[model samples]
Target: MVKYPNGTFAAFRKSVGEPTFKKNQKSNYYRKNINFSDRGMTLEQMINESNKFYRLKEIAVVHKKPTPIQIVKVDYPKRSRAVIKEAYFRQESTTDYNGVYNGYYLDFEAKETKNKTSFPLKNFHEHQIVHLTECLKQKGICFTIIGFTSLNRYFVTPANVIAKAWWTQNKSSVTLTEIEEWSVEIKSGFQPTLPYLEAVDYFIADRKSKNGKYKI
Candidate 1:
C-alpha cells in the first residue's frame, strides 16, 4: 500500500514528466556556465564537503547515500558524457546518509525548517523511524541534523529521543520547548562549515559517562 496520499503521488508523478526538448536545450546551455558561488549550496552539500575533509584528514569514512534511479532514456552528446534524458527515482530513501566513524556505525538524516518555534514531525518518515530503530538495536549511533533556518542554528538530535517523542505525538504534536530541552545545539564553524560531529562526540561521551563507562 502507498504510504502517502494519491494527490502527493500525483504531484511527484507530474513533476517526473519528460522535460520538453526546448527546456533540455536551455538546460544544456546553462550547465556549462553554472557557477557554484552564485548558487548557495544546501546543508547536505556542506555536510558532504565536511565528510570529504574528514576523509582526507583520516578522521572518518562517511558519504551521502546515492539516489537510486532507473534510467529510461539517455542521449549520447559525445563519447565522454552521456546526458540522462529520462529517469525515474526508485524507492523511498531510508536515511540521507550512513557510514562508519571511529569503528561506530553512523546513520542520520539532514533537515532544514523555516519555522521559528518548532521542527515539524512531518519532516520524518515511518521508514526512517524503523531504520533508526533497527540501527539502535545494533548499538549504532543514529541521529539527525536539524537546521533552524529562522534562528540560523543547528542541532544534533539523537534518533532514539526523536523516536520516543514521535510515537508519543500520536496523541498530539511534539512542542518546540521539548526539542530545545532535549537536543544538543551545534555551533556553525569555518573550516568544516558545520562541526556537527563534535556535538556527536560530546553526546556519546556524556552517554558513556551516564553508563559508568567513560574513558579518558
Candidate 2:
C-alpha cells in the first residue's frame, strides 16, 4: 500500500504499456512528470534519500545500522537457494543510523509520530538512550530526527535533551511545545528531500559556541 500527500492509501499496481510515437515527430511526446511532493515516502525513506544525496555530493557519509539477527533455522527449498526459517536478535540494537560528518561522529535515531500534541517516550528504547549517552560521553554529535507525521513537521533534537528528559523528568511523553523549545525544526526540501544536515550544522555551531566545534 502507498500513502499519498493527501493522506489517502491505495494498493500500488503497475500498468503494462509501450510508448507509441507519432511518425516524423521532432520531439518525444511523453513528458516526465516531476513530483516534488515526495509521495509515498515515510520519514525514514526521506532521510535515506537525503543521505544518498549527501553521499553523492560528498557532503556526509551516513547509513542505517542494520540489526544483528541470528538465524536459528534455515529451509533449503532448492540447492541454489535457502531461506531462513527462524531467527533472533543477536542483541539489542542501538540507534537507527550513524556515520561521520565533517570530522564529527554523527549518531542518531529516527522516529515518526502520529500524535499532534506530544511524542511518546515509549517510541524510544532504554538501550537506545544508553547508547546515545555513551556516544555523547565520547564527544560525538548525537541527536534524534523526529517527524510528526500527522502534522508534517520535523525536528532535530539533541541527544543531551533526550537523555536529560529520560533520566530526570520521568515523563511518559514530551510535549510538542517542549520539543519546539529544545529542538531545531527542519523543513523538507527537494533534491535531498529532508534537509536535516543544515540543522546538524546549526547544532555544530551552537556546540562550538559552548564547547568549540564545527561542521561541513
Candidate number achieving the greatest lDDT relative to the actual structure: 2
Provide the lowest-lDDT 10-residue window in model 2: 21-30
Misplaced by over 4 Å in model 1 are: 1-39, 73-87, 169-173, 211-216
CA lDDT, every prediction? 0.64, 0.72
Residue pairs clashing, model 2:
208-213
Q: Candidate 1 residues 100-126, lDDT tens each?
A: 877888999998887888888888876
Candidate 1 positional error at 160, Å: 1.0
Cα error, residue 180 of model 2, in Å, equals 0.5
Those runs of model 2 whose alpha carbons end farther than 4 Å from true positions after fitting are 1-38, 74-85, 210-216
